[model samples]
Target: MQDHASPAIGISDLPAREEGYVDLRSYAAIGDGRTVALIAHDGSVDWYPMPNLDSPPVFARLLDSENGGCFELHPAQAHSATREYIPGTNVLQTTYQTGTGKVRVTDSLNTGKSGRLPWGEFARRIDGLEGTMELHWRVAPGTRLNRVSPWADSTRQCPLLRVGDVTLGVIGCAGEELNFSDRTVSGTITVEAGKHRLIALISTRHEPLPCPDPEHILDGIERTVSYWKSWSSELHYDGPWSGEVLRSALALKVLTHSHSGAIAAAATTSLPEDPSGGKNWDYRFAWIRDAAYTLHALIRFGEREEVHSAVSWLLRMIRKQGPDPEVFSTLAGELPHSEHEVDAPGWRGIGPVIEGNRVGGQLQLGVYGDLFDMIDLYLEGGNVIDQPTARLLADIADRTCDVWHQRDAGIWELTEARHYTSSKMGCWHALECAVRLAEAGQIEGEAARWQTERDRIKQWILQNCWSHERQSYVWYAGSNTLDASVLIHAMSGFDRSERMSTTIDAVQQELGDGPLIYRYTGMQREEGAFVACSFWMVAALAEVGRKAEAERLMAQLVPLANDVGLYAEMIHPEDNRFLGNLPQGLSHLALMTAALTLIEKY
Candidate 1:
């Protein structure tokens, strides 16, 4: 398994400072009301989906570099690029300085207007900065992920309809036929210093021809930017880390399905949290764990409306499906009983790109903690915890008390079922929350029973999770594996005993390669150090009264962030290249929590 880490098809050997595509540094995120797109500093739409956040991506080069299509609006000449967002909005502006001239490209999706479904109309506006610059536009559709070649006929109101097996009516921009192929359209446009050209892509189920006029599309673009700025102003968070918090709030808002209220684990699927490591999992669906983080982040940012809606979505998942737990769906809002593969090529030869999460059916005891904690938060925020939420929490907590002792998949979603220490700790957390709720005069439940259950869980963790041999709590019972998750002990308040100290030292000594921490060495395969786990380690250090080490470790972690504050799922322990989904919610939330913990601790 360790050999997989040093694959024969080696990544670029050039110094990390010089590589271009190897680094995802030059892109910014833009969101319309419904979906988010990654726009590069070079004016290329690297990743985007149409009509819906869960819809198959129309521009997916971020996954399969060659087969996946892209929408580009970059200078024809070589250029230097810089990217940023308009204050308090998801409107991305990337400027390019070329040999011939400079151009400013703005990418955005409009949302929050009076009437708009949770669909997408991607808008790109290219403005000439100085001198005449030649701009290129290409619309390439791919066969991956059920994306089919578009049927182009300018005879109707919409010029092109890129139809696929599952997706219908993916609209594209048209002016002159530059070049058309099985799945692409390319052309060149020249703009003067003060002139601007606008392009838009709208996805509908009905394939229409002769796309709507560019001028009308430009109008939509203006309205979209206006809507983003307006809506962004409503966020009440002006916290210690306000900038990153706001960006997270914006990203989460974009990934959310307005109609369903499901916040996708990430905007992308199959982009390995660790490339070549097979750690990739499709995150296009909703996870109860992710939903918990979303609720917490929104609450931190003081977005109550989104908090209410997101909690409702989460409760819907718990309620619609009967008590027997299962894996949750992406947009459908239920557990998918089977692990069905979608007809999509995997990202960058990463095979078996899937839609539904198979963990839906697994017994994950951690969700018990997530649900109760989020409900408690909702009530504390003055929102009524719906009756369904109360009933569901009580039921799940009782069930956890009954079965948390049983072995199951850990938080990493590993294959084998075991007495994962973290899983049991999560059960302890849920009972603790129940006890807190009863004390706060919130709900009626057997709080004393829950307390007893909680104590039992703690006792079991100390007895079973700890390894006298390793002088630390191993991954689970009878295993000497040192996992980064054990560092979560301080954060979970499991114990501040010598056991935690021993566990932290063991993880740092064994799993900690430099500053980052691996989930577990060869627990499955050799992958980059898990970035979130690194942050968890930092948080744990702070809680365990190692402020100096915690501050130093955090300093190391923050620089791993890209040009923007986005941290991927993992990073190369050697060279800090991002591996996994961009702007991962878990990574960001961990960073936020760790920062807060350190701040308060110091």
Candidate 2:
């Protein structure tokens, strides 16, 4: 509700093509826990999914700029724009300056007085800051991503657009009636200095539509600001780049599903990881590895209630899936299909816009350690584990002893299963945590077997995966490639020896792109820099007693994030453009982990 003096991002050089699609870096996110809407710097609501973040979007201009629908608002005359998040909140304020005047538009998916609203609300407040300005706005609620035909009915006092069972209502076009053409709603309004206007979009899914006046939506906006400020004030962090850390916390909250306590991997899906197409996958579902990392970060932030719910939810889902669970699952505890291509054209004409993740079917042995480590951290924070959950975890540790030798997808979820050294280390970490749990009397398991296998894994990795020539552990057995994933084992307390310390330098020399790091050795030609790998390296450096180097690398990495402190899944090292999904949870989680590791250990 209150705009602060954050640095403004100028949008004078926005990308423009035949379809008028801008770069992914030209957007900022606003959410109300259940869903997020991406507003481009040019005043277009490009991507918004209704009811849930994983649901089919009514506005999908980010994927298909032509047929994909959008909610657009900008000045009628030629102008330039600047954007920023109102401090301490996810609300976005975009100021457009024209030849005659300047106008400010504030965007938010409003919440209730205390918590989330029963329905979905998208509010935009317009204020005339100087001179007289005329602005144009439009709302079209349909996308080519799904099979829905939107039709406008001006029969009621307010204009309504219906898409299948969903009803979208438009309000606030003072002194002028809305124009309904085809399936789109459009209008124009003029305002002088010292005057303001309010426009809101209220929607419903498979239910009757409710007609609310402008003042009701306005109240929701105020409540939303209050809720965000209250939630953010609880995050206890005062380390270096404290502002960046707080912004990452707020961005992580945008990806968290409030109802189920499941954190999504990212907000939008099928945004290309590279420019030439290929490697597009849906990130709407929750990966156990990502959720575990998120839980670790939240615990370090001194958040109790949400961490409890997330640990319970994750453990419950893992238990439901029985042994050797897959990599990810839907927020509602359902399994996503392996993979499928949607019907829409992707961003920048990139095809094969995927709907589900292929990793859902792959066997990632590394997840065992992620699960056990999550439980270990939870218990370390003075939380108690129930008997049944403890027993189930003990059973999982037993299975890890049996499956440690089997080749699988590893942490990257590759199609070709290999004996990845990181996978073996993950299993070793899981067994070590199990032994600790047994020693603490939290779980009843075969501590001796776990210890034997853990030792065997350490010896095996040194024998088969280590390279005497490079003086670092390879990606897999009998290979010369180095993987950034090996950096994660440092945080597991797996290695403080000369091998890990030397491997850190090897990875830095082979994969480092300025401040960013690639995922692996040979894969640098395919994608941009993996956003979380650098953070993992930072934690690894701190773990290996190179505290000064960790501090310096952390300083470089924190400034690489976008102006609003939200990072995508990848970033182009050369051009500094955002690639892949926006507001990636793993990237933010790793950031919190690195920052906290420095504060706690070094």
lDDT of 1 by residue, 1-602 (tens): 00011111111222232222335544467665466788654566778776566677767776666666677676788666666666566677767677788787777675535736334567778898898888788766554455466554343454453556323222334455456665555678787899887766666554332244567667776776667666667766443455655665666666677777887777777666545635567677777887886686567556776787788777877787755455457666855544566655455455566655667677888878777777877778877665666676677767878888788888888789988888888889889888888787666777788889999999888888788888988888778786787676587677776677778899888888898888885732466777778888888988888889988988787766665456667788776776777656677767766766777677
RMSD of each: 5.9, 2.0
Query: How does candidate 2 score on lDDT?
Result: 0.86
For residue 510, what is the lDDT in candidate 2?
98
Error of 1 at 77 (Å): 1.3
Name the weakest run of 10 consecutive residues (lDDT summed) in model 1.
1-10
lDDT of model 1, residue 480:
79
Q: Which consecutive 10 residues in model 2 have the weakest lDDT in total?
A: 1-10
- Best of the candidates, TM-score: 2
- For model 2, which pairs clash? none
Total backbone collisions for each predicted model = 13, 0
